[model samples]
Target chain A: MEAYNYTDIQCPPPESSEIELCRILYSEDYLTNMGYMRGIMSKNEYSERALALTEKIINVCAAHYTVWEYRYNIIKDGSNHNKIIKDELIWSENIILENPKNYQVWHYRQLLIIELVSKSSDDYNVEKEFELIDKSLIEDSKNYHSWTYRTWLTKHFKLYNDKNLSFINSLLKSDIRNNSAWNFRFFLLVNNPENYIEQDRKSIINGLVLQKELKFTENAIELAPQNQSSWNYLIGIYEKFNLDINNLKGLSLKYSNFEDDKISELEMQPIISSVHALELLARIYSSSKTTVDKAIRAYDLLATKYDPIRVNYWKYLSSSLNTT
Target chain B: MVSLPCSLKVAKDNTAKIYDRNGKYHGKKQYNEGTIDDGELKFHLKKHLNYFRMLLNFLPNAFQSNDPIKMSVIYFNLIGLDLCKGVEEYNNKLFKTKKERSIIIDFIYKHLVESGEGFRGSVNLKLPLVDRSNEMNESLKIVGNYDPANLSQTYFALCILLTLRDESMSQRIDRFQILSYLKRCQLPNGSFKPLLDIYGKPFGENDLRYCLIACSIRKILQIDKIYEIEELKKVDINIENLYEYVLSCTNYEGGFGGEPFDEPQAGLTFCGIAILKLINKLDSKETNSRINYHKLVKWLCQRQIWYNKYNKQELDEGDNGIYDNGGFNGRTNKASDTCYAFWCSASLKLLKLEKLINVKGVELYLLNETQDEILGGFMKNRKSDYCDPLHSCLAVAALKLLDSEYVRELKDIDESLVISKDALNFMEQLKW
Candidate 1:
């Protein structure tokens, strides 16, 4: 199932540019189109030809959206409901395997899932979808379509529980730089109804969730110190907890093997993680007097030596941080 | 199957005059290569204009699959050409002296060439003028059957026409019918859907994008500044509820979503914020709801990811020259795209926090990397060399806002419509 060659579907011919559209749509595309024509023409019959044609188009390209629509219409008119949908789902597995990034194919899967769920909302196994997405994600880890579908499914089926946290943790374990996983983790955590907002003295439930996340993220950051997603998550937790930057000052320093008293020997830094750690430390210390001077030194190093490209940002921080 | 139900001229000869039948602009025009104020870019501004000029006259058959988004492609080209320089520069040896602007304008007016359930002609549902037109109907003789007027296409149609809106262009079509039809797309929830059929079946893809377009249409179609709010209130819609519905789309992340409970996206963020600004609800103190602009500024500033800084962009010589970092990604963890440059930049401009971004860095990523030095169009990203007119149009709009100096005679553009100030003023001048 290679994509269609451009000459196959080019308007006239032979003017192929860099990005090839589908090779001319398959002859099945033209035949399968008959199904859509039958659907739109309101012929309203689940004819074997219509079913076969729809299957051909789907087999050729799972993203053939019109064929899916026509197939759905024909099913709505008449047919074996469960078997047809289950067959389509099984067919989608091959399509998803071939084209993991096809948003349209995933959308078709989602529409089918919704149909199943609507048919028996009370009995629908939400775990099956979670597993399906988990499988799809295994194929293409950072597939935005898979992640968005996960989020939509979670919200749709009320699957936002500790189970999701474990799923995201598994993803992060595989690739510490899986930023989408990190983002999803944050979204799920923040939107959790159980994680109540701080009331009369740091609500214990909220604090526990924050502390658990903070520890979880700190573990990930230790593994891939230069991972921006981890750092963002750490910052998000710090913001969520309304914790002071001074608390993590020592950890940030040691993560880079920076000796506190020997800051004057600043030329020893080489790892990229230390630079981001230092940058975060500076942002946290924007108004702190005790660490302001050391933060300035770190900023100047980041500006001139370490990450010179964003020197404007580091220099701006160095100049402005001390002023406040 | 291209219909000619309306008596408008096709102007095939005129098109040939615009560019010879082969599609070349007929003559080469040199542009000022004066030092780009930043001096950090390795791109040629003049070449972009030339690239676009050629693409417009002789479109590649490769873009035939993009039939649905054809109107969008047209918008991008015309507006990109406009932003890159001026419409005058689009002329050549033949199209040069003979009202070249009229050729482009006529090309746009051609979308209004047919009838449907809601109007005499359903311009386009999702494709271009040549390869598209929802020709699901032609005559009203069939009493009950009629084709639906796609709201998003109609909005793009009016927005494109208003880019060249003059006095008489308003008279050629039924404005009242168009205006009434546009309003019908609004759902009771205050959000606007993208399509409304002839039998009044609503296609329920309500989002900030369509709502922005609907609001822009209302603003563009209004004849008078006086009592405009009063007229809007008179319609069978709740402006207050509509405003509230819009407010719900805002998330705590300092960004907006397509709908309530949706994730934050740069494009819809602009649509949400801009629609509010258009309807004058952005600053209203109705619910004491304050948007954390500072947090939003931080979020948006971070969207400009400089690929050279960290990621490995392994391109060959000539290709090895420019880095693709810091290009705007529409979301938190997405690839940088040409269109996001516009969406992110437009949102920043509307929010008035655009200055926080490194101006020099953005110029390099957008102009050098995504833009095809040869093709004159912008690709969606570095990985895929797939170029499209939408990307080309928005990328130029982003550039115009980044610095107007590169583009001579750049109009003061409104962030909402992304149309020039003069065009917006022209729309204002038109009476119903």
Candidate 2:
């Protein structure tokens, strides 16, 4: 399906080649674009004339942020709630589908969402936001725009629960290294989750929430032993609280695959950055240098053998061990 | 796969070969077998000089795909030339006489909106929306209406002018106007937006990128160094809030992202550290007290991805890639690209940890692997044949970080502006 149908809005051919040359030299589209630019530049009153101009221009060019900013001022100042804002939401969806990476399109849509919610949040239709994000994220799983907007929707409209966690869980199952989903899971489980900040600080990450997150991440790590996202989630949980670094030694050792005598896994080497879990385990043994010596050596082996590119980083870590 | 040009052949022998378009025997050419030393490969100065000069031809499609980023393409293309050829030499070649420099400066300055210190992507193209001759009275209507200015473009324009400025170049801008624009664009939270609305509130999103742009502009204009802005305009940087906003963007992973608690990225990490360095907030004592320097340094070093110099056909079985060329990636496990070499390594430089990187490997990657053989511009990656101005510009800058032989001719670049120390000196010499 075509994302945006600008056929009706495209500049029609001039009457003849002479006018077309004139159009090329002094293109009607250029005039339209510059008119909006000049309006925003001069802070001109966004009259009905400016409104018509914006409608025509945004029809063809949604990336012109100056035009969008001008249109925002015009609508907000004049209180033009005459159904244009709703149409703008639909138009923004078309733009988003056409150009998912265009940041300005998402920003414009967000401004429209704010306008609608301020008028009467009950009619905001937040499911549209969810659906729009779903489509965008499906296209690019690492898109922070959709993830950021998802956080806003959850905070403003209470759109998260076990269902959201389950969806993210399915995403992680599909690709165990989807960092965006892992980050979203942290937001839901930990700090400032879904208006949870309004409640007492202690209620933010209560025992149940922490337990569930630990279990979820532990299972994820078990499923994909080499996925850095799983390890990052485990470390993220440890860092979120003022928990002792020593406490994670148990989880680290649990995730460790020292006993898995798999040759195929040995050939397909683990990533260098993924050895943070092993390093954390080494650190846990740091109280006594003699006790930590073996784990530290294991860390070196992982860093050097699996990820030879970052031998310098491994050397740094090993040297710091002696100093500490 | 990108469609190979007709004259090129994807040879079984690894190196791409120049061939006749038709299926015909192409004459044998000797392939350089051994790994070339980084010191041996001279900067392809003439080809790069031609590469950037060709961009100015405006071949009707030179910047067609980059229509939205017109200012950036112009600014970085000029910078790419300046890095390959000396800035003064480039000045002599592009604009010889004083009159010529003035003309080019005015062309850039025309993009500046009168309301603020910002500049738009380009001069707003005038279209014949209304028949000015027939439908309107020439005397009654307004003329010379232009587009609004933005933070990124303003940053590009000011630096471009400063680089192009010499002794005879005049300071045409009112510093107070630009300073006030930057000040007003700051939100209560201290991060900067791209532009401010008519209400003096921010119009767009706030991020580390805008913050860096604002601070870099501050450094170039030397708003603090100049005395006039204190009385003429309110020139306060909500220091408390700004510091808090920047600190908020710092991640537990020892890198920064666009927002607090977001995914850590190399580019945003550069912006954050560069902002701190620019504003004189990068105190090692206070910052290291909180931030894990070991992790941060380790994280930066790990951004060096495995970049094998040899193609598949050239690689022997069981080769461990010990002597492969190295390049920086933006994220933890992403493919290496040209721009992040500057972003990641420059941040490491600011952190006093540049020594940890494999300098020789990176220099060779920038000079040999990523550089296009035919056009002399850097591509997004080793595999890409297309030339991107921003990538080419940053690769040259990253090459400077490696202390390449070109350093003697090129200007010394500080971490913040990515400009020649000489050009920055020239910027400092400008009087309001």
Candidate 3:
């Protein structure tokens, strides 16, 4: 039980003008501990005490990249990485729960998982990782870090199964406006790990899967007419597959009927139409010479009443259609 | 359309007289007709200048957790000062002498991790220059080996140096090493990590932000020239895959997400488009085919919050507030935020569609709602009382892009770079 000789690093005096609030917020004891840790880190001392100090430092400043880097280095240099990795995983889960929005914690977790997999793939539990990420997502469904990590894990582990799709489906069922879920659905459909080849993915999407997804999206749109996520999903499916917008023309007309008489009175008292449906009808009509006028009328209505915030955009679209 | 409860009267001298609904005088300003409250709206340049100056000197305890990316905070403050046309005056006050200027220059350079070949976010990891040279060779070696340089920090440091007009920046910067660092940070999938581990493995979130920063660093340092040199070819990035990665992030909604299969966001959309513009692939056939260009423009335009009551009712709950009528939101079904004004507008500006949105509406929203009249600096939203550097800098930059009468005093910004046009010109003149 020898005492560790702490180095004396000159910390800025409390009264110094350049002292950042980050430093000022630190207690004297905390600052002293950090100074000692820094002294050890500078000397490249990768010991148990140094490793323990990193934990102490990280608890306070989870976003501190340097401490995370130091901790990773210590674990990398350790003799028993299996034990360290397991312990760190459990430790980081708590840290992540406390700071779900922290960029550094998720990254550190990624590093640890990558390291663990590299050492012994059998020991790496994909289910546990999923549970952790799912818990994080439950806390905040739109958490960008959590979603990104989930996507990365899916691709990395090739966990493209019913579980993944059902998870996304449940998310959508709860909140159809969750664009993140819609985006993930697109990713799952197109970049399914099972279909490694582009041709395979194309064939899969062109099959009954495409019809099912389209129906699901259209139904979601019907439930919430203004929800842009479902509309974007429908549009994404069509554009990515090069499907004709005319296919949705029947559905588009259900929400917006742009007849000659209706177009004439759009300026006086605009009909209550779904903005998305009107835009879709406009896109569909602009494709053919016979219906181009109807497209212009739709754009005019959108510009004047439905979506006046983007009047210039609608006007630009109408003008472009005219030139074509 | 709901008319504002105000009217404008123009005089012979181009000065506008603003009156309330009752025709009582409100204020007078040098204004143009048709612009919303151009006569009464104020830029509050002096107040914003003081705000930036104060932030530069010291950030409050509220920013305690942001200690790691201190360079970026400095970058935001410096850019804000530049936007306010206060950089020269502030520099004169802070760095009155050559020695003082060199001290700052030296301080920034100290963050450079020699072994990592990039700049660390802060100087906390590395010992002081005197200590490193005299008594801490072992510590210095460890710091050099273990200290990771961040992509964003590297970008921020380079920009700060350029803003300071550091003549020797090109010479002082180790271009080859930094390029090597960038090369190491790139993943096999063409996305980039913000930092590398001690083992030289890129480990961090792979997002559009890092990709954008990586591209910016490459452009600023002119790393493409490395390919001309036989030995330096290893430092070059995979431009083809990088382009593919950026295009892959394009959402069906026409905006981009942080990563592929993520929700399209205004900030990431800007980064994605800016990356393409920087790499000269914006108009490539692949880009034209991969992206729905018209849909992207429509999506960006859709970000503007309108004053219409019907549209407000249709929008997400809690977004019915009238104060955000002209501001832009980062995503669909989201409330308007101060930064998205710059993000969406700049994205449109890059697409050559700046005129597609109502610039007057944006100006009015920033001035009347988000701009903190008493404190200076812009808030995140109308309801926010606090103003930070990010929102304030972006609000000003967004205004500068509009080149409206309200922002006539502010210097123009290069939309893609988000730096003042004059500063960009100065950077272009540098030897690097």
Q: Give one digit per residue, the lDDT tens place, for model 1 in B204-269.
A: 346677778777766666622443566644543345666878777765455676666455678888
Writing each residue's lDDT as its tens digit, candidate 1 over A1-324 gives 333222221122112333211122224444334324333323323455656655654554453334555566566545567666777778776777677776557666777788876774357576677777788787568776677777778767767676887888887787776766876776677644333233412443347656777788788777756555677677766665568766877667765543443443333333344555777766656556786787787788666554544555566557766566
Between prediction 2 and prediction 3, the one with superior TM-score is 3
Task: Indicate the residue-level lDDT of A324 in model 3.
Answer: 77
The residue pairs found clashing in candidate 2 are A31-B127
Q: Which candidate leads in DockQ?
A: 3
**lDDT of model 1 at position B299:** 62
Candidate 2: which docking quality band? Answer: incorrect
Query: Docking category for candidate 1?
Result: incorrect
What TM-score results for chain B in every one of the models?
0.75, 0.79, 0.86
Candidate 3, superposed: residue stretches over 4 Å from native: A1-33, A76-80, A118-124, A190-193, A196-207, A260-270, B1-40, B114-116, B128-144, B224-234, B307-313, B316-323, B383-385
Every candidate's DockQ is: 0.10, 0.19, 0.31
Question: Model 2: runs farther than 4 Å from truth?
Answer: A1-63, A73-82, A156-160, A193-206, A250-274, A292-303, B1-43, B57-69, B125-146, B166-170, B226-234, B307-325, B360-369, B382-385, B404-409
Worst 10 residues of 3 chain B by lDDT: B8-17
The residue-by-residue lDDT of candidate 3 on B62-112, one tens digit each, is 665565687888888888899888877756876788777777777778777
